[model samples]
Target: MDDSKGKFGFFADARRLRSFLRQSWRSADASMRRGAVVMWCVGLMFTIFGVVGDVLETWWSSMPFLTNLLTSLTAFFFAVPVALLVLHDVSHRMTDRAGRRAAMAVLAQSMYRLEASVSALGPVEHSRHSPTGGPPLTTGSILEAARARFGRLQDLEGGNAEDIREATETLRTAIAQWKLDRLPDQFIEEVGRVDIEIARLRDAVRPRFLQSDLEWPLDRQLHSLAEMANDLIKRPEQWTIESYNEWCDVAERFSQDFDQKSEITLLEINAVFDLLRHVQAMHIRRTTFVQALHDFNLSARTALWELSSL
Candidate 1:
């Protein structure tokens, strides 16, 4: 089937040209279409005027005015419209191509950054990805993985290394199953890998990304996370004995300075609030990733690798 699609000859070239013109004409601005209509009318008028002027010139053989009028009409209508049309068409095409390239570049960058956020989700793979070199994961699998990991997280007693490890692995498994279209399988597939895939997606749509949905959200999120660091410090990635002692010392000092009841309440409330915010942010990022993929209009079954010739 793919081979057949690749076959191209005179008829194929003609078909492609027809398709291009048809799509371009359909997508063209109304003013441009109107201008095309005006150009066609001008050409027809030029022909008609030249014919009538020739008859008048013949009738008044000695009159230079009739001949000059015909010549001027031909030049004014023919040369001017043709030049304007050429410039308009070329400029539109250049603008269109530039817009598409920029959009693809944005997409490539988003995919790169989004992949980094996915690490928090564990080893989820796109439907086309096989992280372990085993098999491609699917969307269903990733969604399930997210569910199960959330469950595991809830079940944890003390957020011990073992519990976090199991939950993390489960998270990975579900994601590996998710098969986001070749994600976890090769997330390092940034810029270089994603660029090729973005190029493919852009080419498939004829690079018509006149505008993009991905404005500055990626940057905004990163900056927000950096600035909001103090908002959550419930469970650091690692809790050393020294840090535990320090925390205990701080609690003792606070209790000595003030009522221990309020200090304890404050600590509990702060941790819970921080944890809630962190969880909320994580889930939001997940949905954002999913939404971004959906907005890209990527085929459900088309994995990044399968979609493009990397």
Candidate 2:
């Protein structure tokens, strides 16, 4: 006997091939290995039924059709379960992918809204500190006050679109009233226009899963800016030439760097000087919110990747 050959030479290579295939099967992932075993068992059952049916056909010539029908039914029964399993797995994967994609899109869109709102400030000046060299416009006290007003958004998990919209509308009214009291000559008209724009944006806000991921943070930043501005406005004591110069410093910092449209006018340049401090103070909070949003997006992507792997 040759070491490589069996009793028959033809069996040698075929035996090695079977050994190799078994090794390959053992190397597969646990779930896939189980699936392969199940399918192999089903295939073996079908093959056995076919052989048995053919053997029976020789014994009963008049009933050969019955055996043939049994053989076909065996294949059908086995195929139905495999097909259904495949369809179910495919549907589950698709639904999972779609859900992750929708969540990511909603988060991105909410970030976009905040980005646009921030850009609406145009260019901010370098000096973000207070004019008298005290605390900045967005002082800790001012932020605490803003947070007091927005309890839900400051600590939100989830909310319906209508309820969030209503809350934002109420916030808008409060900010508008504060503006009327402080900068009545400028912000009275400006607040109305801002309200109209805000209404349009709010109405356009659609329902989304994980929507609070964006809404709460973005609203928090906006409210903080509003509160800071109102706080600055209330200080008639600081309305000195130095404060005016600090406002000028920030307002004059704007150039055609990013946006083409200029919201600042020579007539309201004085008002813009006053408005500039709020935007300047908002820079820190804006950066904080943006970093938070970035982390959120990263987490969402990681979840999506994990889902894909599964």
Candidate 3:
């Protein structure tokens, strides 16, 4: 029985290894295809150079025989249909890559927006319309509604509320110290609005907590996102493919970090704050980003299509 188990484990390991290799090969093939397209485009430029050089030599010199030989060689072997093939391959690959990247960027943007919106719902009390028959909602009523909507208050019962409040306050202090008062009016207004909301929520929840120590993990994440946004805003012209890729990387890291640290029960709390509205906003942003990319892809496709038709 021991020997049989050992054999089974060995076969399982072997199968896993084989599967890994197959995947690696497929990835390698795709990379090679992309590289090949680039190289083919470069080769076509060289072919054009060779043809032009031959033609110029023929016109400038009196050597008919040599000129004819060179022209014939370049035209037959280097110039004609090969350049068209290269152009087709390069354009096709570029379109495919652009479409893929655009999709990914949109996905990243949506997640980032969702995270921001969720962070906005930090144990806050606000006047809201009451579902049951009563007077117009008060801040206290809103808090109760939020608490009730987010079931299993056990997580929020402990130090979680304090942690959130502290982290938010720390973020606000940092932003204030950064002396961003001179920033664009719109940016200052947005930041001020968020800050006011944070302060209101903190004041509402402070009585229940013993201490308000900053949550290091959450603070770090907020700081990182703020820094990235600042950098991008400061130098929008520096936004390149690489910059966009970095944005995606940061957004993904933020998502993963938030997931690892956040309690699963928090999703319930999130539900209380009209989470669907936030998600809907994120979906709209995502759709807009995707549409922009789709338009770019269509433009690329049209160019290729015209070339192919010709």
Candidate 4:
């Protein structure tokens, strides 16, 4: 913190400060930087005229008016431009720097927020249910986890190094996964209720006024979709991202094809089309949201990998 300089330190510090300011201004816009040059030129002009007027006072004792005119010109330039230059630099450039700092701060906060949100979507470092386990925790934590998991000394079952390592890793993952607290149980219950309602509706959703032409095909697609939905009810764990994508594709295509080929414009059949349209909208929204998540997830992963490599 000490800023006190030794002998000859004033010149050294001044040169260093000047160099720092020079480097800082190098990145400034060319047009904006011309202001500094103009200010320097104005000040230089005033200095030159002031020195000439003083020298002329000695040479032209009879021409005092001419000498005084040069002095007056020097003062005139200083009185106007010097004050304006100082005011402009302080008011404009300082304000610009402050504004940029504020904008950059907000931008940085937004980027951090996006990063955190994306990172949260990835698997937890330690989760019992997560297929991808996290990195190692503390020193000898893996060994401690294996020790905690052991039922009895005989349960070791003459394990090889690979088996021991695998068992240790599984326990460690569980221990680490504890970091993530479960969301409220009410949300889980609500999700289950919604799934049941969806299955029930899907099961009952079929067109009564089916013709052999386009209606039959639409009916078949609807039945297939219902089956897929019911399967998820039975085993939600069986579904993957690809499975959801395929489901969305099937639902979207069914909706589109029905719109194109469906000639049934009867008052009663209008209700069916309305229901299908609503379902189509829901599917479209879900598909869009899922796709955005997928794209962002991929981009985040690529960015992380590249950064880690560096």
Query: What C-alpha lDDT values do all the predictions have?
Result: 0.45, 0.44, 0.40, 0.41
TM-score of each: 0.34, 0.34, 0.20, 0.28
Candidate 4's residue-wise lDDT over 83-193, tens digit each? 454455456556655554443343344335444433443322222332345653421343244344332212443234454344434433433332232222232233344
Name the candidate that leads on TM-score: 1
lDDT of 3: 0.40
For model 1, what is the error of residue 3's alpha carbon versus the real structure, in angstroms, after optimal superposition?
21
Give the root-mean-square deviation of each candidate in angstroms. Answer: 14.2, 18.5, 25.4, 22.7
Candidate 2 lDDT by residue in tens digits, 1-310: 5655764566787887677555554444577656755765776787786787568776645677876776676676556545555555566556756765675565456445544444443222222345468965432333333333334433443234443444334333323323322322232233233344334333433233334232223344344444444444455434333442343343333322112332223333233323533533543443343344344335445544553464
**Residue pairs in candidate 2 whose N, alpha carbon or C atoms collide under 3 angstroms:** none
| Candidate 1 stretches greater than 4 Å from native | 1-24, 56-72, 75-90, 110-310
Error of 4 at 292 (Å): 14
How many Å off is the CA of 300 in candidate 4? 11
Ranking by TM-score: 1, 2, 4, 3
- Residue 94 of model 2 has an lDDT of 68
Q: Residue-wise lDDT of candidate 3 within 1-310, one digit each (tens)?
A: 5553364677777877677544433444455556645655665665676567667775536667865665565455444334444455566556656654443344334334433543432222224444577776543333333333233343553236545333333323222322221123243233344344334323432221213221112233333334433433454433333432332343333334434543334553344234323322332332333333233334434433443353
Clashing pairs in 3: none
In model 2, which runs have C-alpha deviations exceeding 4 angstroms? 1-61, 122-125, 128-310
Q: 1-310 in candidate 1: lDDT tens per residue?
A: 3343454766677788677666666656788778767866786787887678667766645777866876687667655644555566667778766765566555555555545444432432245556678766455554455445444445442244454444445444433332222322322222133334444444532233335322222334333432332222233322223432233343334324432232223343344334334433443443444344443323322322342332
Alpha carbon deviation, residue 133, candidate 4 (Å)? 15
